[model samples]
Target: MNRSPRFRTSRTLACAAALLCGAQGLSAQSTAPAAPTAGGDAPATAVLPPVQVRGHYDNDIGTSDAASEGAVTQRLIQNRPALRPGEILEFVPGMIVTQHSGNGKANQYFLRGFNLDHGTDFATFVDGMPVNMVTHAHGQGYTDLGFLIPELVRRIDYRKGPYFAREGDFASAGSARLALLDTLPRPLAEITLGQRDYRRGLFAGSTQLGESGVSLLGAVEAQTHNGPWKVPEDQRKFNGWLRATQRDGNSDRALTFMAYDARWTSTDQIPAALVENGTLDRFGSLDPSDGGRSRRISLSGSTRTTLNDGAWQASAYAVSSKLNLFSNFTYFLDDPVNGDQFEQAERRRMFGGELSRVWDVTLGGREHAFTLGLQARHDRLDPVGLYRNRARDRLATTVEAEVKQTQAGVYGEWNARWTPWLRSIAGLRADAARFDVDSSVAGNSGKASDEQLSPKLGLVFGPWQQTEFFVNAGRGFHSNDARGTTARFSPDGTESLDPVPGLAASRGTELGLRTVIVPGLQSSFAVWRLDLDSELVYIGDAGTTEPSGASRRSGVEWNNHWVLDDVGLPGWLLDLDLAASRARFRDAPSGSDRVPGSVDRVASFGIGYAPEGGRWFGHFQVRHFGPRDLVEDGSEQSSATTLAYLRGGWRPTASLTLAIDVFNLFDREASDIDYFYDSRPIQGGPAAEDRHFHPVEPRTLRVTASYRF
Candidate 1:
């Protein structure tokens, strides 16, 4: 399929988005203030309280528009013993997070039967800053979560499908928003030690700003680790953040600054045949010098103020980040003499902002709400490049480019309660974007533009018997890499190529139910189907995404959160999540409809005990992901993976605590990640297709001590 710039369509959508923003701004000025309360004073807007770590579950049944939407509080995040920073996302039902290389790199994510390689179909945000990078050197929509400090996260709000008006690019499958804490109730100092030369330190505190109604919070962490690899990882990482917040009668405001830096050696996946034949160990590396370094710093601010019978919110952020990564996916396939090691590098700056307003009005003796929002973002990459390397030394340049990408969007939604047992929500969104690239190869330098308009609808019925039913449908999209949107030739200039569409569209529908029929238990189930206009696959050799055939995926999910209080165990909680999905190409021949790397089954079970005023707490968890096809013809497949984790802690006094964490508790010899591709394991050997895998780490234990003042 050939895709060209749609000038007229893009202009029309851009104008529509801009006009909607203007109209909403004008209407908001005429809204009247809410009436005074019984005490003859304006009511204060609801705000989230300060962060506290305890055994508490947030209730979302009565407040959610969809059964697949929920919030995870600090209680769950603090109690879980995460081996990697990105593991925090596992709290989302049916979501899997894994790593194929170094711990400091972006994680491999899978959800809803889609292999969301490096966050293509999943959008993520930290505070108000977007975490997905556009047109990155490594891949499209590359997301790195190493900068996040799990302890500082107050809550994580997640929604599945594209049924929300507030979400835009990269949100076809789902989205997550992480909110940070503004203050700490008590200052804390901690130290941790483990085998394999692991060590870490952390310090955090909060204080008032001289009675100015402003509070200042600061935190810093440093860590080092050497994995169980033949070549020690020798990872070093540092993270720090500072935030200042002020809350007045009807307004809230905050400013935050964050910085992160890391460097590490990676143990890339090895050929399975070699490992099986004893030519290489499971934890061995073909290239010892393969590694990466990254740096990120950002400043952001947000404000929320009461406006008439509603609220207004605004946020803005600026970020500067850089990455230098080196890898050898195909050791000697491309270059038998020098070995096929390559480097990907990028230096980029990003700026973005969002403005929104919500109004609550009564119509015909019924409650109704209307919301309008506008969002804009810009990214500038001074130099994004790919190079051929040998033993960490650059041998030649493949491609280099300077690119700029900009996007703007607007959405409006209306929600109304038709009756005591019936409700409806309807919404529409418009988005537009422009991509410009100046490449070293003149044939690949050009400009392109595109736009899209999407509609969303949801209906809810009946709380009869403590159960609610829902129906939802929506449209969403993800942008392709800027370089791919205008490229006319391959990086090596040896073959011609075709430019891909700037944006690929997706449509989704879901039928779900939420119930609390059993006391102390919350259960939800959803059956969903999603269709894509085009599936963009990552091309490792060219460092870009190439468009593939259209595809369809259907899945079912069951999530349960049970508190054992009513069962005579007041301090115990059990959680179980199960999902199964089928994915296939829409128009593929027989025996080739299967989508590679799409797992069909995922399950997780966790239990924890944390009673109020208790001196001891413990949590145990098990996770499993079923096998998947590795090729179109299903000629090869991957094995299933399962692991267990244990966490236990004791409080020695009111201000001191001790904890122990065990990962891979059963010593399972599973693989963290796997792939099937052509490579030459030995120099000057014939290229052959085989399985490649990164082995899971062996069982490990860590101990931590913390003091609060």
Candidate 2:
């Protein structure tokens, strides 16, 4: 019932598309090649900013020998609206987050045409502690991020791919490092009054408690909404965080106490018209008063100590999380008798802790950054399903599962500044993880554990201060649980479970170049190949809707950001940001190409205007996502989509400011999201190939006003 287009056929088509786009890009460039700016070719030396690991700025390029890129970047954090790091760089080149469940679905972003897998695609690190759980794929990525107020984040560095010493296992696609600043003081509050009795407000404050590095911090955000789909955003969010630390005057040996809480609840579900007709709200939706609620809370802390004559830093951290998800779903079916409606409830609690250390050892004239860390987590997931039968009898089935996993790794990276122009980092890690899953279901229940040794190596060459070339090779590993093949039956009473899902493993290689045309201009380009052999995705159970398989994805990405003609344009400045990517699968073990569901090729461009160091600013952005398949059945072709947004912001003084956010500029056609898996069977059968694209959200606008003192 399912006919797979030959790999060659799809690849040939992809190649043609890439060629066309490449030609168009070339045409867009000015007739004359860009001339090197004055002082752009400075000699490379200690004069240059340190070349750090992916997504890290404050952290030195110590022994953290990353498997891939070492592109040093500087991001301007001013006159911009950024709720989270993802917001500011959401439009960054070489990256995309095809999100679902609204923006709160923090973990559900897609990057480089790869699924965030909830939070598995990229792992976040604070200092040296891992924020993503070993049980990521299906669960929450932030886990308890709501508790950590984003307002407290000083800087965030995001990187994708290749292993390095500073990071550990599960850091496959990439990683992010968040550095929290304690001395900075930002106090502010804002309250908004809107239509449909909608109201929202936030309050935050931070101060240095003492010179020894003791600090106090607090923040809160809240929202409320009543929807008619006209002003369709009935949601509420709150976040609070506090911290205290004592450090030696030399900035070493620090003991810190950290605690935070984040909770978001929304009662607005995607409207019907908003899903199909992104441009119209023709008819009143079926249920305008229905929606969903999501809440998550977390708390943790860490202690860092310096030993061995200032040659080492050691730390231990622990985090706990609790979450709730409630959804009321209504939809009309076209098949198996049509007219189907449902509601579901899900609750989860996960708690764990990790300890990590970094030892800075000086051997002769070279430095070695050695890392040994271990993480243990206990995840208890409870999923309940309620179904209505043909006779209108409501039947309920519950799935209770508890999973405990312990992961520990040892890594050592040696970055040799072998020459003024060339540097190399070679590192290796040995990781062992064991999973214990206790599920109420019988035959599908079992325990599986695996250990792996991942090797990472990278080389960077700076021909000139403005240019750097790099290469990296590393392996990625993740485990899968056997939980989807339960006794829950479909509306048609089709039994599940044919082939048990297996574990997933990956290995990849990447090469890239980053350069600065000048202090204010930056650019990067990378080409990579990933070999993913996945039995079950990290986000879902194996052998569920679609069969799992081995897959290969390789792509090229180019990115650039420039503060063009800054001095020439005066108050009117033009900054350009561009991204382009293309992907092709050399082999898809499963006949279906949906093994990895993400857009194959995509691009985005943004132009902005702002006061050099003033308070008010705005930007106009154009985002384009190339057409691609999500379900591999009949292409599941989603037309390429484009969206636009604008903002008017002002900061009257250092402590007070206000702004407005307008999304879907022209009310472009957009989708909320489609159900990932259709009820269609996976085995070759009459129903095997039937699938539908989940609907997407419609044009929406949120007016925001803020003040800081």
Candidate 3:
């Protein structure tokens, strides 16, 4: 069996060439990067293990006996500073998160190229209770996820691609499920104080009562902070959660409850010029006089039933919320006196509920599995309340507006493990949403319903024991329904003119591969391409409308990491994360429709050192935002920027630790939005609107001390 030197050399060269090619392809699609081995010249990264991840860009793999994907845990969800449920998921790549100063906007989520409508296009659920906003004064919903304190979440799973039916309506692109997994070891508590006069306190406790027939876990956290920035001052939020589980036979069912309170003053929208070129030290902030705040609360529960070799699950829950916007508008005002008062006030209220079920089958052999499910959601919204307009010297005038919208649907998914080496999953789901608006505002009230059907498919192949090849493709859909404006009017039958119903019907796809070379190291890469059609867009003068077709966000990323099997540090782990992506939106009807304010390329990467034995560790994260055009023309609107963050933690005892987080380590200035519309020379050339950007939180430090029993 011994080969000649010439034959051995030729074979070795061929294998090397093939691997090089495969890796190149993977790098361009997957965010997976490669790490250098011991004594090698290449770079190395410490990575989170391939447990399973759910987020906006991918679809469901279900929670069954077959296998479970990675879900964001309570500890992880609470690790960062946030006021609402969506903030925990905002940092994910390919997703844009809109956040006001501090953590006040808890019921709203604008993701995956979606405007902040009713929060319906994206699925929302807690434990098993569906969360939706049926009374979308615009597209705002009643899903107040602000209930779960950073400590209450056992784990959160995100399947961001074509959603499933059992999870219910408004889930064209992805579905979100928040659940409690198990009892914690001990009671944990912490207090955090951050830059800009931010302060937060937290408490948590979990225990197993085998003798009492209960597994209980609960947590409470409250945040009250005054922005060091401007306008949006004196903000506060209180979140609490409780979960109790009872085991019966091969099945275990749990009862969970959550509550939240948030209040804050509104922040003004910075004008275009100041946002684009203002120096870091001179940026304008929301005026302190704007007083807009929202109060939200939710009560929910979910149960699970396990069968022989399979499992069946069902959940039901509801939520209610109210928002008060006592703020001024820079535009669209019909009176000069009220405008001179420098502010206007609007109050909104919303309520909603959800129900769903899921089934699992494992008879197709020990290695194969299948899943089925159905779900429904309902919501009610009051965009605005009537107001008697009275100016300092003018007579009283009455005005009123209301926005109502609801969504319901069903879905299913199937996963297969054909061989020890190959696995795949497929899914389909559909939903219907109704939007109605009535008021003296626009005389544009209508009851319009939109239905969506979507599918998902993905496969993973094991080439070797440690390396797996993967590919995924799915259809994504979102329908325009209405906006969540506190004051706006739509005719009862004006449904045909509603742009949101057909605005979100579009599709996207992705492909990737991963490798683990044995024991302590691994790497992967992937390339993605997305094409959008019938994209809903807007022109300031022409109003909001659905463009003919075509918009996109396609790019490649290379991510990699390694955890040495027996590194000297006992519990210590080394890690690195990297990502890069490109996005663009084109108006098929004409270039004029290609409004600016879109980023072209975005990137992020970082490194960390954690000891295996524990005690203390340090980490650094870096992020890059590509250039963007806020004004929507084909011109450059905002320049790209890079940011860095550093973190350090110390564990004094087995159950106690202290940590510090520092952002903008380099002290660089950044903007949340890009720029303002530049119409200074619009008549001379093409019409253009400049973009106004949201200023970023400046360099600041946050410290937290915690104890976990």
Stretches of model 2 off by over 4 angstroms after superposition: 1-78, 82-92, 102-107, 126-148, 192-198, 208-213, 226-233, 251-291, 305-311, 314-319, 326-394, 482-503, 538-546, 564-596, 612-615, 672-705
TM-score of each: 0.93, 0.75, 0.75
Tell me the lDDT of candidate 2: 0.46
lDDT of each: 0.82, 0.46, 0.47
- By summed lDDT, the worst window of 10 consecutive residues in model 1 runs over 35-44
Q: Residue 557, candidate 2: how far off, in angstroms?
A: 1.7
Error of 3 at 708 (Å): 4.3
Worst 10 residues of 3 by lDDT: 24-33
Alpha-carbon RMSD of each model: 4.6, 11.9, 13.8
Residue 390, candidate 1: alpha-carbon lDDT: 92
Write one digit per residue (lDDT tens) for candidate 3, span 126-229: 55555554433223233445555534444455544442223334454345565444565567778888877778888877676768767777777888777655
TM-score of 2: 0.75
How would you encode candidate 2's per-residue C-alpha lDDT over 76-130 as one tens digit per residue? 3333333333444353344554444433434345566565555555666553345
Judge candidate 3 against the unseen true structure and give its global Cα lDDT, from 0 to 1: 0.47
State which candidate has the highest TM-score.
Answer: 1
